[model samples]
Target: MPAPTEITVHQQSRVLEIAFDDGTRFRIPFELMRIYSPSAEVKGHGPGQEVLQTGKRDVLITALEPIGHYAVRPEFSDGHASGLFSWDYLHKLGSQQDALWRDYEARLAAAGKGRDDAMPGKAGGSCHSH
Candidate 1:
């Protein structure tokens, strides 16, 4: 997988602009990142246990801490900071943004919820599976 050559957080645009060593560049929205976080709190332990994220339209990356050379841990303004975005995963997310956004919208519609809707009850518990 191509590693990231650059990663810039555009706070005003609410997007993360990433460029890879392979010459591919992507501007992934912050909303998309939060909803598709690879954390266990979002992905769950196994199939059918995934948690749907909501009200993340304005989520911000408070911090981006590098986990060695392979991944980066993002601390979102919504208090979620568990997902460690690996180089490969980030590449995938950037490459699949459009399809992923469509899927997210479809899931929200299926659940009768909106992107700005607050999650029902409290958020899910933390897990190290990320």
Candidate 2:
């Protein structure tokens, strides 16, 4: 994976704009990035231990702090800021955005929940109870 040459985040749109030296630019949504975060709270310790993040469709990133030269720490509006997004991971997300997003949507559908279902007062959607 190529390293990102620039990363500009749009707080209002809740999107992260990444530019690679190879001329690739991707606008990744905040919800997508939050769900796919590499943090232990989300990724867990191993396979099958991964936690399905709910109530994040409306989660917006409030801050992004640079971590050294290879990663950025994304602070979300939901109070999750532990995920240190590495360059390789960001690149992978950009490359596999379509498949990942599709899979997420499918999972939500299979669980009988929509993305907005987790947001409490928004559209009067409620969290899915398993």
Candidate 1 residue spans exceeding 4 A from truth? 123-130
TM-score of each: 0.92, 0.83
Clashing residue pairs in candidate 2 are none
lDDT on C-alpha atoms for all candidate structures:
0.89, 0.83
Candidate 2 — what's its lDDT?
A: 0.83
Model 1 per-residue lDDT at 95: 94
Give a tens-digit lDDT track for model 2, residues 1-130: 5778888988788789999987888898899999999997778777766666777877888889999988999999988899999888888888899999898888778878777666333345233234
lDDT assessment of candidate 1: 0.89
Report lDDT (Cα) of residue 12, candidate 1. Answer: 92
| Candidate 2 wrongly placed segments (more than 4 Å) | 119-130
Model 2 scores a TM of 0.83
lDDT for position 49 in model 2: 68
